[model samples]
Structures are given as structure tokens and as C-alpha cells.
Target: MASLSEEEQQARETIRYLVAASRSVPGGALASAREDWRAQLAWWGSQGYHGVTLPPEWGGQGKSFLVQTMVVEALAEADANLALLYEVHNTLHLEAVWRYGDEAQRRRWLPDLLAGRRLGGFAVTEEEAGSDAESLATVAVPEGGGYRLSGVKRMITGAGWYDQYVVFARVPEAGITAFVVEADTPGVGFGSPEPMLGLDSTPVADITFEGAWIPEDHRLGELGQGYAIALDLLDGGRVGIAAQAVGILAACLGRSLAFAQQRRQFGRPIARYQGIQWMLAEMATDFAAARLLTYEAARRRPEGERQRPLYAMAKWFASRKAVQHALNAIQIHGGRGYLRKTGVEHLLRDSKVTELYEGTSEILRLVIASRLLNGYNWDSI
Candidate 1:
């Protein structure tokens, strides 16, 4: 991995200490963040994490994308749920508004977001449109001075917790379009959070838009541009997910190394054994490689179209390694790792979702294959 600048190194250290301190409470960081999410959000905002990549004029630190990814990795190492929420809010919502929203919209939204008065979410996936995102069942019909959105979006992070959402719905003649809808809109309703195996700290629910009225100004970008905008947002989101994976992988290696050193068998520490040594070696290698892939993807983000496949490769490989290392960590811990109290199992659960979202492992393979078949030079990326 490329060496971090002095500023980046300082930022990483600061966030790592902050998160480690916050997670020191009972049930660790995940439980604390989950139980008191509002407070956690406010804390993150006060620390300037919500705007790490935004311009200074917008009340942000105006840091580079690499710095933002570094912050995310630190958050993930301490708390995967916090990292997931941070990634979704910054990469998907804040980025969308900053890059696509008009001046008026930015003035209306940026302050509250920076202050933690409002949290942002992106709503796009539907029950039938998980991987095939374009097959949206949500529809927005033109009305007087606005549009009426009526459809359901499933698996939305912060579905009820978020103050506002950037919703995507198919228009009669405009195809899929994006709109910024306040959660309290007259027709917006939310279902109960879904029960999941991992990352339980992060809430996921379905949103129902029963003819919600959105003013013309709420529409993001031009008509028929939602698909492109969503794709662009996903590129950034993929990089964030990859960073989160790197964090999880780091945690897996750290926990396994400590366990191997202290764990004794046959009158000796397990770290002295060849089998345990090999597992630690592989886990360490995976952590290093995933970090490099994620850093490369973040560095090349400005290349636009060329970076999509790089994002895919980084997300895919990093997430896969994270899951593998999590399992290995558990094996190294034996009975202790399998138990929930150990907290090592949580990494496995959190790592599995990385492969399924932004783009699934199956979907990412096709994306990379398409790039290779197009005769693009793989070395250039």
C-alpha cells in the first residue's frame, strides 16, 4: 500500500482512538451505537466525519477520498455498524447532493446534515429489483407543480431513522428519476426493521410511498437521469464498502494473532505451532492485499468510467478475503470464537453482507468480465 501523508496518518490515529474510546462501554461499540444512534450520529458530526470529503465552504474538512476511506476503515475496525451507516450517509447521500443538487438544495440540506440534525438515506432497491436495479416498480406520476410517488423500496438502511431520503422512482415517460423526499412526507410510511444475522446494529427496513407528493424542485438531476446518478453513487459506495471490508479483515487478523499468542496447546503456545502460524500468515497477507486494492480504487476514483471495474474488483476481493479471514479467526479461537460473547463472530456476519450489496459477487464478476472483453487494458486501471 502507498504510504499515507502526514495528515492522513494523523487523521487515522485520531479517529482510531476516538472510536476505540467510544466502543469501550458495555456491549462494545456496536451495541452502544445501535442503542443510542442519535447520540452517535451527533458525535460523528461533531468530529467532522460526515463531511470528510466535502469542501470547506460547506462546513467540511475538505479532505481527499483516500482520507475519507481511512476514516471509514478506522470506524469499521471499532464498529462495523457505525462504519456502514457512515459509508451510506456520506458516499451515497451527501455525495449525491453535493455533486448533483442545485445551489438552493445544498443550502437547505448541507447545514442540517453537518450538524447531525438530519440524517440522509438513499432509497432505490425494491423487492423485485435487488440485483437488477433498473427493474424498478416504484412510479412517480406528474401532478400539479410536482409528482406523486407511489411504490415500495425494500432493504433501505435507516429507513425510518433517517430524516430525509433520495428516492428513485420510474416516471411515465422519463424512466427512473431521483427525488429528495423528507421522511415525514404525508404518504411516506416505514415497515419494521428486518431481522438479519449480522450487522444487527444497523437498521434495515422497507419504505412505502403511497402517492407521496414531491415538488418539482425536489427532483435531482435532469429527467431520465436517475439510473446514471445511482450508478455514479454506487461507484463511491463500492469504495467505501471495500474500506469497511479492509477494516473487518484487520480486526480478524488482530484478534486471531492475539488469540494464537495466548492460546496454548501441548505444553506450548499455539503461535509456536506450524498450523496456527500458517493461518496467521495467510490472514496477514489477505489484510495487506485488500488494503492495497481498496487504496488503488480510491486513488483512481477521478477516472470516472475507468474506475467502475476497479471498484468492483476491490469490493469483491476485499469482501471475500474479509469473510475468509473471519472464519479463520474463529477457527484459531476454537470454541471461544463460535460463542457470541467473543465478538469475533460478528466480523463474519458483517463481512458476508459486503459481498451481497453495492453489487453481489456474482454481479461483480460479470462487470469485470465485461471490461476485460471490451479490450480495455487491465494494467491501465
Candidate 2:
């Protein structure tokens, strides 16, 4: 592994401090901060977390992509839900506007979003467009000087709560187009938050657009560019999710190590036993490997399309290991890990979502295989 630069080290320290501040609230250590998310979001924004990867001229920190991944990892250690929200906002929503939007659009939305006064969402997934994102059913019909979008986007993070959304819909002449729409648009409505398995703090819901009017200026890039934009945004988002997986795995490993050291069985510390020792060693190894892969993906993000398969590999391996590490942590804790209060069980649940989102484990495997079969050259490989 390469040595960390001063900028990366400083960024990690800043995120660590910010995460620690958000860890405590009115009621004990803010475990999930489910009810206090509003305050937490604002606090994180105030601390400059939302703009870590944005340009300095845009009132952002102008940090490197690698640094941003480190921040995401630290945030995930504090709360996976908040980490996901942060990743979506910065990597997907904000990046889309910065990379594709005109100056006027950037001036209109970037300030409030970076300051954390407003939140943004990326809406692309539909009821039937999970892995098959190209099969979008959303329609964008031209009307006068603008278009009226009509579609229902499902599993949107910050759906009802976000101030604006970067939506994707199909145009009659175009294949898939991206548009920015405010949440308060006349025809825009949100469904109740779904009862999800994990990410309780950042509940997702369906966003329905019933002829929601979108001005021409709100369109991102050229017509039919949504597919490319989604792929670009997802490449970055996958790296962030890999960082999140590393965070969760780190938490599980740390807890399990402590538990093994203290919990005595048959009059000796469990840590002394070879069985417990091997589990800890494996957890540590996975954590190291996952973190390295995530960092490598972030570092190679500037290479664009050529490095996409690396993102998929990092996300898949890290998330898969995260789930397994969570289970191992629980096993080490025995019956105590089964109890919800121990928090190990919660980590297990959170790890499951990492594999589901940002391209599932199965999908990512296909992506990596496709790249390899095509004779793509990766230095490390």
C-alpha cells in the first residue's frame, strides 16, 4: 500500500473529529441518530463534509477523491445511514450537477446544498429498473419551453426530505434524459417511507412525478445523456459504498476483538484460544484488504471509464466481506451478539444493504468478468 499524503491524513482527522461530535446527542451516544438526523445533517454540513470533493472556488473543501472516500469510511463507522446519505448527496447528486449542469444551474443549487441547508437526491431507479437501468419507463414529454416528467422513482434516498432531485426519464426523441426538479413541484408527490430492513435513519420512499414540469435549463447535459451520466455517477457512488462497507467491517472487527479479549470461557480469556485468534486475524485481514481496494478505486476515479471495473471489484468484495465479518462478530459474541442492545446485530443488518445497493454483489461480479474477458489491463492484476 502507498503511504498516506499529508492532505489525506488531515482529511481523515477532520472527518474523525466531525463524526465524534455527531456521536453524542440529547439521548446518550447517538446510535443511529434516527430522530436527530436533521440536526446531524446540518452539523455535518457546517463542518464542510458535504463539499469535501467539490472545487474550492465553489465554497467546497477541494479535497481529493481518495480523501472523500476516507471521510465516507469514518462517517459510516459513526452511522451507516448518514454515510449513505452523504455519499448519495456528494458522489451522485452534487457531482451530477457539477459535471453536467450549466453555470446558472450550479449557482442556483450548489450553495444551499453544500451548506447543508438543502439536501439533493438522485432518482434513476424505478420499480422495474433496478439492475436493468436502461429500461426506464419515466417519460419526459416536451411542452412549450420545457418538458413534463411523469414517472415513479422507487427506493430514492432522501426522497421526501431532499430539497431537489436529479431525475432521469425517457424523451420521445432521446433515449434517456436527466432533469433537475424541485421537490415542491406541483405534480411531484412522495410515498410514505418504506419499512426497510436497514438504514433506519435514512428511510427511502417512492417519488411520483405526475406531469411535473421541468424547464429546459434544468436539464443536465445534452438530450439522451442520462445513461452515461448515471454510469459516471454510479462509478463514484460505488467507491463510496465500498468505503462504507470498510467502515462497517472495521466496527465489527473492533467489537469482536474487544469481546474476545474480555469474555472468558472455561476460566481463560477467549482471545487466548486459537479459534478466537483466527477469527480476529481473518477479520483484520478483510478490513485491510477492503480498505485498500476502496482507496485504490477512489484513486483511479480520475481515469474514468477505464477504471470502472475496479470500482465494481472494490464494492463487491468489500460489501461481501462486510456481511461475513458482521456474522463473525456475532458468532464471537455468542448469545449476547443475538441481543439487539449489543449493537452487533444492527451492524449485521447494515452490512446487508451494502451488498444490495450501488450495484448488487451479483451484478458487480458480472461487471468485473466482462472487463476481464474483454482484455482490460489493470496494473495491480
Candidate 3:
């Protein structure tokens, strides 16, 4: 990887400062739990980092994806929950609007979103559709100079809290279309947050739309272009997810190493044992590989090539590697790793979700195989 330019270095320092502030809040890990997390995110937005990647015309710093990735990685290393917030903004909201929204639409929403004056979310997943996004049942029908949206969106991160959301709904003849729905829209409502195995700090819930109405101008991109927008956005989002995994693995390895050097077993430090040494070696190897793949994907984007396979590979590999690293860290700590206060247990629990969300391991494998066997030639693949 190339050395960070001066601007990138400054952005990194800013993220580090934010991380320090985040950890200083009362309640530690519990500080960001539930509604409190929204407050925290709003506070970060107040600091003017919310639109760092948006173009200058839109009140953003106008930085490249690399800079955004660096900021996310730094935040993840400091606090994974904060990193998740950035993912919600950068991947789900910012990228979607930038890619799909028309000039007027961008001018209307980008400023507030980029300035952090408001929060945004992406609503796509449903009870019947997860990986198979094209099979989504949410429907949008043409109406009086606008569209009527009706459907249920499940497990949307920051759903109830965000001020705005980019929702996807199926159009019978035209296919899926993306719409900009305001939180206060007449027929938009959200359910209680669903309990999750991890990321409890980041709220997730189901959203229901009953006769929701939005102007046709709110549509993101042309009709029937929602799937393309989603795929491209996910490709970008995958890099962020991979970065989160790297941060988690790094944290696990650091904790495990410290424990190994201090804990005594068989009348000596466990770090002296060959078994412990081998486990550490494997963890280190995987962490390095995952990081490289992630950065490589980030780097490949500027070359005008689609990074679908690379991003999928990085996301899948890093997520799996993160889980294993966390589990190994647990083994190294024995009973201490099982304790919630030790933090290793939480890391392990949190690591598992990385593989399940975004794209599952199985889904990514199919994507990789398709890319390889067909050389990404859709006509043949």
C-alpha cells in the first residue's frame, strides 16, 4: 500500500480524536447501546465529519473512497460501533445518493446528510428476501405525479432513528426502483428494534410503508435501475465491512498476545508453548492477508474496473478469518475469554455477524465462482 498523503493523514488524525472522545463517555461499551448510539452519531455529525467524502459543492470534503476507507478503518480500530455508524452513512446513504440521485435530488438531500444535520438509511431487505434482493416483494406503483410505496423492510439498520432513508421497491413492469423517503412521511412507520446476537449498540428494526407517497423526482436513478445501484453500492460497502473485520481481528490479536505473555500454565508463560505460538502465527497470517485483500480492493476501484469479485472475496475471507481469530483468542484466554468484561467474548460474538450480513459466506462463494468460471462475462457466465 502507498503511504498516506498529507490530507489522508489529517483525516486519520481527526478520526482518532473522535474515537478518543467516544471511549471517554460514561458507561463504556454500554454508552452506545440503543437510542444512546443515535445521540453519539449525531454528536459526531455535529463535528462536521459526516460529509467528509461528499463533493465540495455539497458541503463535503470531496475526498476519494480511499480516504473514506482510511477514516472507517481508524474508527473501527477505536470502536466498531462507531465504524458501523460510518458504514450506514457512507455505504447506505452517501454512496446511494451520489450514484443514483439526479442533480436536483442531490442538491436537496446531500447537504443535510453530508453535514450530519440528519441521518439516513437504506431499506432493501425484507422477510422473504435477503441475499436474493431481486425477489423483493416491496411494491411501488405510479400515482399522481409520484409513487405509492407499500411493503415491509426488515432488519434495516438505523431505521427508526434516521431522518431519511433510500428505499427499494419493486415496480411490476419496470423492476426495482429506489425512492427517497422521509422519516416523517405520512405512512412510514417502524417497529421496535430486534434483538441481535451482536451490534446491540447499532439499532436494527423493521419498517412498514402503507400508502407512502413521494414525488417522482425522489426516485433514485431511472426506473428498473435499482438492482444495478444496489450491486455497485454493495461493492463499495463490502470494503468497509472488510475493514471492520480487520479492526476486530487486530484487537483480538493484541488482547490475546498480552494474555499469552502474562498468563502462567505448566509453571511458565503460555506464550512459551509451541501450541500457543502456532495459534498466534495463524492469526497473524490471516490478519495480514485479509488486510491486503481489503486494501487491494480499495485500490483497484480507481482503475475503472469493477471490484465485485475482489470485494466479495475480501469481505468473505476477512469475516471468516475474524471469527476464527476471535475464537482462537478465546482459547488462548481460557476462562477469562468467556467473561463479558474481558471483551474477548464480545469480540467473538460480534465477529460472527460480519459473515452473516452484507453477503453471507455462501453467497460470496457463488459470486466468486461465477466471476472466475465466466471471467465475469455475463453473456457466458
Query: Which ten residues in a row are the worst by lDDT in model 2?
Result: 25-34
Top-down lDDT ranking: 1, 2, 3
RMSD of each candidate?
1.6, 1.6, 3.0
Please write out the lDDT profile of model 1 over residues 1-381, one tens digit for every residue: 346778877877887777776554443446564547767777778778786778888898988888878878887887788788878888899888888899998898888887777889999999899889999989999999999999999999989988899999999988999999999999999999899988887889999999899999999999899999999999988999999999999999989999899988899889999999999999999899899889889877777667688999999999999999999999999999999999898999989999998889999888889988987579886
Give the range where candidate 3 is weakest over 10 consecutive residues by summed lDDT.
24-33
Which portions of model 3 show Cα errors greater than 4 Å? 1-14, 25-31, 303-305, 376-381
- Local distance difference test values of all predictions, in order: 0.87, 0.87, 0.80
- Report the candidate with higher lDDT, 2 versus 3: 2
Candidate 3 residue lDDT tens string, 1-381: 345577766776877777677655532354255566566666666666675667676777777776677666766665676677778787778778887888898888887776667778888899999999889999999999999899999999887888889899988799998888999999999999888887767778999999888889889998999988787778878888888888888888888899999999899999999999999999999988888788777766554235578888889999999999989999999998899877778777778888977888999999888877866743321
- Least accurate 10 contiguous residues by lDDT in model 1: 24-33
Q: Which ranges of candidate 2 are over 4 A from the true structure? A: 24-28, 32-35
lDDT of 2 at 352: 97
Q: How accurate is candidate 1 locally (lDDT)?
A: 0.87
Which of candidates 2 and 3 reaches a greater TM-score? 2
**How would you encode candidate 2's per-residue C-alpha lDDT over 54-168 as one tens digit per residue?**
8889988888899888878987876788788878888988888888989999999888888878888899999999999999999999998999999899999988987888999
